[model samples]
Target: MASTSGSTRPSALIGWRVLALVYDLWPVVAMWMVASLVFTVGYTLSGHASRENIAPFSALQWGLWLVCWLITGAYALLSWRRGGQTLGMRPWRLKVVAADGVSAPGLRALMLRFAVGTASLLLAGSGFWWAWVDRERLTWHDRASGTRMVRLAKR
Candidate 1:
C-alpha cells in the first residue's frame, strides 16, 4: 500500500486566495489609473489635446494602454526574476515558485506569462479562473510560466 503520511496538497482557502488575488492585482490597476490621469491631465494642460482637438484623446488612450502593458510586463518580469514576489504580492506574504520549486523565473517565461495574463483578462477572467480549479491553484500565467504562488516560507 502507498503511504500518504508526508504528502500534502498545495492549496489555499477561498478567502486567502481572494486576499492573494487582491494583493497581487491592486498594483497593476493603480499603475494604469495613475498613468491615465497623468496622460489625460498633462495633454489637456499642454493644449495639445483640448476641446478643440479632442482627437488627441483617442491617440492618448492607445498610447497609455501600450505604456501600461510595458510597465506591467517589466514589473512582472523583474519581480519574478529577482524575488518571486511583485510589490503587491510581497505585502500579502505570497511568492511565486517554479514547479521545480526554484525562486526565480526565466525572462522568456516571464514574458510568456505576462502575455497570457493580458490575454486572459482581455477575455473576461478565464486566466484567473484556472486558479480556482487547478490542483496547484495556478493561474493561466502561472501555468505558462511553470510557477505557483505559495505563502512565503518562515524566516
Candidate 2:
C-alpha cells in the first residue's frame, strides 16, 4: 500500500513558507491598493460615495473591502492554477498542490484556499502558525481547502 502519512511528502519548513509569504505580500499589497483606489473612484462616481464616508459600516467601505478581496483572490487563484506556484513561491521552490499529494488542485480548491487563507491572516495569522504544531505541518488554509504546500527539490 502507498504510504499516506506524508512520509514521502517534500513539504517545506514553516520558516521558509513564512518568508515566501512575506515576499508575495509585496505584490499583493500593491494590487490591493490599486484595486481599492479604483473601487473608491468608481463608487464616488455612483454619487453614493463620499470622501469622508469612512465609517466602518458604510456601504462604500464594505464595497471597497469586498472588491479588494475579490481582486486579491483572483490574483492568487490564477497564479496557482497557471503554474502551481506564485512569484514568491518560485524563489523558494514551493508549490501548492492537491491534498491527496498527486495532482494540481482545481479552481474551487484554489478559491477556498484563498478565502480561508485570508481569514487565517485576519485572525492574527493563527492559521499559518498552525503548521508549526500540526501533525502533518499543514496550515488551516491548506486543511480547509484540501490542499498542500510542497517543496521542490533544487534542480
Candidate 3:
C-alpha cells in the first residue's frame, strides 16, 4: 500500500479526468441502460406502461426500479469504499477519494456520493458534461460530494 503523509492534494491531470469518467462509467451506464430497457419492457408487459396506470409507479414496477438502482448503487459504493476505484478505474490505475486523499471513504459518504451521482444523471447528464467546461474538471456530483478521482501514483 502507498501512503502520502502531508497534505493530500490531488495531482491527477485533466486528461485523466476525461479518461476516468469514460473508463469507470461506461460499463456502469451500459448496465443501467440494459436494466432500464428490461424494466420498461417488464412494466409495459404488465400493463403498467402508461401514466394513468403507473404514474406513481406500480408496486411491481417500482420494485424493479428499486432493485436496479440498488444494484448499480452497490457497485458504485462498494467499488469506491473497498478499493477507492471501480473495476474500470483500477484497470486504468485511477482511484477516487475525498479531497484529502484518505484511504477510502466511509459507507455513508459513499452512499451520499452515489446519490448525488444518480441525481446528476437524472438531470439530463449536463452534470457529466460539466467536467468538460469546469476549470477543475469536476462534475456537479463531484463538487456536491467533495470527492475527487485521482490517478494512483506509479509504483
Q: Each candidate: how many clashes?
A: 0, 0, 0
- The CA-based lDDT of model 3 is what? 0.70
Lowest-sum lDDT 10-residue window in model 2: 1-10
- How does each model score on TM-score? 0.72, 0.82, 0.65
> lDDT tens digits, residues 1-155, model 1?
10122235553333454575577677888888888778778888886745544464687667887999897788778887888777766665666666665456677777887798789888887887777777666778878877666665445
> When superposed on Cα atoms, how far off is each prediction in RMSD?
4.4, 3.8, 5.7
* TM-score: model 1 vs. ground truth: 0.72
In the range 117-144, model 2's lDDT, one tens digit per residue, is 9899999999999988888888998998
Score candidate 2 by lDDT. Answer: 0.82
Instruction: For candidate 3, give the lDDT of residue 94.
Output: 75
> Model 3, which residues run further than 4 Å from truth?
1-57
- In candidate 1, position 136 carries an lDDT of 64
Error of model 1, residue 123, in angstroms: 2.0
> What local lDDT does model 1 show for residue 78?
85
Tens-place lDDT per residue, model 3, 1-155, is 12242324434544665576677667777787888778777777776644444456668667867877887888878778777887767755777788576656667777777898788878976777777777766767668777776666556
Residue 63 in candidate 2, Cα distance off native in Å: 0.8
Question: Which candidate, 1 or 3, has the higher lDDT?
Answer: 3
